[model samples]
Target: MTDILIRNIDDDDLRHIDALAAELGISRSELLRRETKDLARRHALQQVTLDDIRRSVDLAQGVLDEDLMKQAWG
Candidate 1:
């Protein structure tokens, strides 16, 4: 694991973060770590979902005639 140093956070923001960490019974570092991991996981899942959708669209292209598509959509 690598260390990250964030500089110049506002005092009020730091206090709020500390309070939240305390509420969750975790250290501030642990709270930040968990949130960062969760954000990355969600982003990866979204990318996978988008790729699947694009693949499906590619596979479906030209399978339907234009007239049929228009009628189905309308």
Candidate 2:
């Protein structure tokens, strides 16, 4: 992997990051990697199956109940 350096992190931010690393029993670098992976996963979910994402447009127009989506699509 390539190294990416981030400068100008605040003291409080560093402390919080360190605390998270300690909480998860990881090194600070591993903690940062996990954090980035989590952030990417959160955004990536939008691109993955969420039951019925195509229904989102119909949802805005009051066309479906989310609870019923599985039965409808299944």
Give me the displacement of residue 56 in model 2, in angstroms: 7.4
Q: Best candidate per lDDT, number?
A: 1
Clashing pairs in 2: none
Q: Each candidate's lDDT (Cα)?
A: 0.91, 0.82
Q: 35, model 1: CA deviation in Å?
A: 0.9
Worst 10 residues of 1 by lDDT: 44-53
lDDT of 1 by residue, 1-74 (tens): 99999999999999999999999999999999998999999997776577798999998986678987887688
Per-residue C-alpha lDDT of model 2 across residues 1-74, encoded as one tens digit per residue? 87889999999999999998999999999989878889999998767565576676556653366757766677
